[model samples]
Target: MSATRRQMLARTGAAGAGIAFTGAISELFAGTAAAHGRAGYGPLVPDPKGLLDLPKGFRYQVLSREGENLRSGEGKVPSNHDGMAAFGGKRGGVHLVRNHENRVTAKIGVPTVKGLTYDPAAKGGCTALALDRRNNVIGERVAIAGTAVNCAGGPTPWNTWLTCEETEDKAGTNGYTKDHGFIFEVDPVDPHRTGAEPLTAMGRFQHEAVAVDPRRGVVYETEDAFQKPFGLFYRFLPKKPQGGRGSLRAGGRLQAMRVPGIPDLSSIQEIGASFDGVEWVDVPDPLAVRTPIRHQDFGPKGVTHAQKLEGCYWGGSSVYFVSSFARKAEGSAGDHYGQIWRYDPSRRRLTLVIVFGPSTDIQLPGESPDNICLAPAGGLMVCEDGGGVQHVYGVTRRGDVYAMARNRQNIGTPDNPEWGEFAGAAFSPDHDTMYVNCYAPGTTFAVTGPWHR
Candidate 1:
């Protein structure tokens, strides 16, 4: 690594949740772009292959492509790859549970395997890819099947993947035989442990992602609704908190977060602004049999709502989540390009860590940050889901931003040239490789480099 990157890493490791850390992040969002250096590897060197562009010393390998026959011979690889999680496997290898965000009408859906199908008519779910220590794909198969619009989910402390359905399509609607929108657990190591069963107790309505608090076994979830009244941040209090696999299936209480005076998260503009005494309001109906969770009445002080709530993960003692963006034109109460909020369970506080752009510049580091994961080298890797060019960004602990990779392939016509969004964004168990997926023409990539220790 360069001296600049080394210093940045050292500083990131030493920084804590204090004034210094807050101020650095504030400057980043306040348009003081001059304060940041190329804290990561360096500027992205264009890919000669015209696919993914990465830094000079970095390289990426394509592991799977949509429409291709699976090695397992079950069917073709599914399309619209989304959320994912990586776990340690046998002999220092890695296992990745990946989501296929296919709607009921998609041409190539996750293959239905015996015992894995939740709804034979539904066309979305997850698949597992086992890679050797050197990152070579050894096995791939359908992990969970027959779910709808499986978007993004978090991993459990006990070594399982929670695949979420990001839809509200009910039974008999659009050919769905059962209610969609619920979280399902998948065992990447043991296929027998992954039964395609939905955790119904966890309120459903377009779930985008989830974060599990290891200490309390609470699952924090985000909703990505496009209509007015948007989506709410939720937490599922499981009856068998911390019980190994199938615990969530036992059912739980679902509740949404409410900040005293703030009705919408997008209204908050100040970075490091903390809200204390945040409360949770129970969802009267987790199943959304009639009204969606966010649309349901939460008594006097209504449940707090935010637009484009996506990407959530637990780190340290806090659970961090993202609001992709908001606009008054889009029925949002307030406007901003993106916001990353951290909530401390012990203190019951929610603080705004970073906010970026209401600008037209797609080059802004915080433009539509989605599917975020804390980098092992002391930072956060954010997948950009905004307009123009899409990039995977690295935000240092001190809030410096750098582009880690760029999507250069044009999946659309030459006149349109559409670059699909990047999703998943997980690191291998060994931290030597980063794995992420391209949502269009569906593709999975394993990236390796001279990472900073």
Candidate 2:
């Protein structure tokens, strides 16, 4: 009768649900990499040495760093950097919206402007940085006040940042408001405004990143819960068309995905293989109504639990999503370490675009891909979440991959570099400038590339 019980019955048959106490296991355990077929692709480019390295003529410079003294007298830099977006710029100058993924850190001192402390541990959140024509930090301000674990988020068409909290526990461990997981709208210019509120209409979940569909007022969200079944990939369609401009408080429709014709669990295992093919069924009304088939249903058969779905963007006619981990099987030619999938609205299908890392035989050795962005030169730029060598990777539309820049800090060893993981890749309106964030050290970099065809 309940959602969980219905799902269990659907997977193991009505009769199997009663066998739980009879020592009969209805679930099948398969190796993580055994599902999904290989997608075709070759290596793109070798890793880079400098903080950022692009094709000839392209160069990058640090716009802001954690612990750096800001013009506002805020001593030291911010940590746990993530999602970023550039707005209101012409040629070289612009305003940047960035997220600080720190939940609680005694070293940073609760980030408050002047004499205000929203919480004893309000350090983890989002910030607004003003940049000059040359991509230099002129000023920085805390955009969305009193939020935690502000991770990867997308830019709205109306010029605002949708900062998402990566945790679900609102009543966080220390009895602090627990504002770790939820979506918040931040205005870069007036970040410190007292009326800013969290949008509970987005539904409370372990939100990782979000992408807004400007045309439809639809918000596509990704979750990062691994242990509790597969995380759900959701879409929030505001009740009133074009209603989510400066506020996400208006309730909306939330929907998940189903595999459609795949009646048996075994068929679900075959869906992740080849990228060129495969279809996804959209489960309408995931938040409002209960459905027997959910995204987590596919996890037992090696599916990356839809919760691992991270970054997303509206590219071409479809929306593309990135999976941080989807390793290949023991003897498969194509590796599944990670993959880029596209959801075609017109065709109502999902397709694999690029496969990264050794599993796909595409990445060098240890390249775990994360937040991605569309390049001005017609390609996708992916941030590496791996070791000391974490760098930004460029994958052309033609499937050719290359390393765009390095994270500047080595995360693999004990030294544990200060710079965090490179993430939230976004280009200026003109595509001439690229802005990236380091997740660990919580720093932001602005780079100018030589535009060459």
Candidate 3:
């Protein structure tokens, strides 16, 4: 049996996943207005190390960094750290499974362990980190190796990590010996349990992140294709639902979402707007051997498409997903900095819960909201991936957005300081710590402070 939906969300600190906490989309904008004042910890204080800035009384420690030697001595830490998940370990410790969104050209890649390597020629995979109660790194090693573009993924109901490949690159195209673009299950506590095999039945495409429905044992997926064609929202029904580790490998049926008259989600701008009688359409070819899943035919009614569909998570009995941003110049139906949508399985309905901006103001609180997780304190913690200063923002249940942390790391010269987008923001089961990733000059951080409860 699987964990109940509330138990899963509670474990993940996703109880606040419903963006419209007050039950009104209008409250989101009102909260935005209230954001002018402070909603979270007062303001961020600069870090002397120039790595990360947090509010007073809060501190961050670098748990892992690119090119650093791994504790296992298998190899150095890989580059392009992306999505991650935290699980409770023995004696008040925490275990994290992190993804490396590397390609063939990366200088340091996940080492090819004998049984863990999926394709020696490929340079993307996942790594596991073991930390004690004090947030000290106790053990670290490659969880899965030899994949490609391992991007954002989700945690399972039975204590496992699902790592996704964000590329459609084929075996021979870029020195990859095996076909890329599939989800792989990684056990945080035991590396050997991974088996390093892709779940091919979930469909082939540029997958971003996933959210598992513990109640129904369903997996909701998001695609992050850059341009014109965009991407589709997907759900996979496993043959053996919630059978614990490695059960997804058994097989599954893949399907895309359809919203009746709405061909593109970007076209819907009104807040709180929703569509009923939402349906799922079967993909003619889940493998995408002949045509990509989104490009495949779904008849005249067509299927719903969204630009830059990224972060996904399950909470409040609904599947919450994000559209990082869309631009009209790039062939989208409309333009917006960010959007958060919720699909309620019980109601068979989809609603637009949060809308960021159509404005170009870099200082806006909601600019290009990427990886998101509901905070244990009853709000959403959003990672800003837009231009200008990079920040980890906090959005309250009432919709107020505030800066919680800032990337002060300057990887470049004073004339041009480079800051990477934050990804994989998740909280511990005890709600005492939060873990996130810095995409460039890859670094993993464990943040601790006085959080609202």
Candidate 4:
């Protein structure tokens, strides 16, 4: 998904994927608010390492580097590391599940396992890295294979990853024998030995990410489709996801979000738009072999649609998701940088939490939030995949945004941005270290500092 995840957001002289980057270009250290507004994590000090620039007193360690051979000896390190999450492990160690969003090609691809292969011809899947307390990788291997476009997935309290497929490829295409676009579970402890079976009950679409409500076992999904057809926000009510390994495999009701007052949530121009309770109407045929799931099912129920639903994570009793960019041409009244919304299940209300304005330049802190993860320091952290110098932004508990880290790696790239789009920015369970991905020449960094508690 190099084109879908990174190039799509940064493409300006192009259109078609998601939002195009027609804005002016500027240097990373030139803009005021664009470079970084305030000292939320203290001012970013240029790094001597030349890989990443962090704030004063903060430093980063490389956990995994692309181009290195895989631990499983399956293939070289996978690129386009998109969505990821951290889990607790032995004696302060952590188990990190990373997603490789590579497309199908013959020679180069992500590693695949025999029994767990979904599409032998496909290359997209995920890997699990075992890191010790000091934040050093102890093990790394292909966790899930045969899936297509493993963009992002949520970690379950049951200690598993629900890796998602961002492509809607069918069987017999590109040498594929199985229909793609479904979620699969991977065990963090035994990622290489987990099940690759698609959670078919949870509709098949161009899925981006998922947020699991640990308390209810309900899985909320975000679709990364275009506005012409519009993407649908869905939830899966697993019949037996009562914190078990094969729980979601039981299959349950799949439904789309229907806001009672807002017919099309994307059309609302307001920043802090609010909507009373949402309805979840059943999606009769989620397999979507013939009819697209959003059109035939969601359209009939008048389910509210968003521009391009991307990152989704469960935190603070709410499922926070990203709607990358909305424009008037796409039926929305006005064009905005992007929006982040929080859906509170208990209150049964959805609140717009964050929104980005038009970028002054295609540079470092440009908006269009993609993958999101909770900072160990009590706030939300978003990976910027929009045009400009990509970064991983931090959102305070009080709603203040700050530039946490800048993509200062791969200094010799031909790309104007120079740095790769940030992905998989997640913190360890111990709250001592946070991990991030530099997309293309895939690199994973473990950053630690005096994080705000």
For all predicted structures, in order, the TM-scores are: 0.92, 0.74, 0.92, 0.87
Candidate 1 per-residue lDDT over residues 137-231, each given as its tens digit: 99899998999999899999999999999999999999989989988999997766768878889877899999999989999999999998999
Write one digit per residue (lDDT tens) for candidate 3, span 1-453: 111111111112335433444474332233222322336776678788888989898888899999999999998999998899999999999999999999999878899998998999999999999999999999999999999999899999999999999998887888888888899999999979777888999989999999999989999999999866899999999999866888898998899999999989989865568899999999899988878888899988989999999999987578899998888899899877788888998999999877764333454345788888867666678888888668788876555566788887766778977788888899888878999999888999999987742
Q: Positional deviation of 170 in candidate 4, in angstroms?
A: 0.4
lDDT pick, better of 2 and 3: 3
Q: How many steric overlaps are in each model, in order?
A: 0, 22, 0, 4
lDDT of each: 0.83, 0.57, 0.83, 0.75
Model 2: what TM-score?
Answer: 0.74
Lowest-scoring 10 consecutive residues by lDDT in candidate 1?
A: 3-12
Q: Candidate 1 has what TM-score? A: 0.92
**Which residue pairs clash in candidate 3?**
none
Query: Model 3, which residues run further than 4 Å from truth?
Result: 1-21, 24-38, 358-365
Model 2 agreement with the true structure over 1-453: per-residue lDDT tens digits: 211221112122333322331121111111111111211122222326435434455566777777777556755557767888889755557898888777665345325654223444466666778877877777876665556677788878778788887765545565666444567777776665423466666756667787776677778878766543546566777776575455456676565544344322212222233232233334433322233223323433322234256887765456767666632332122234455555655556654444444322222222466788766655456787764456676644333345566555544465644445788888887667888887655567777755323
Give me the overall lDDT of model 3. 0.83
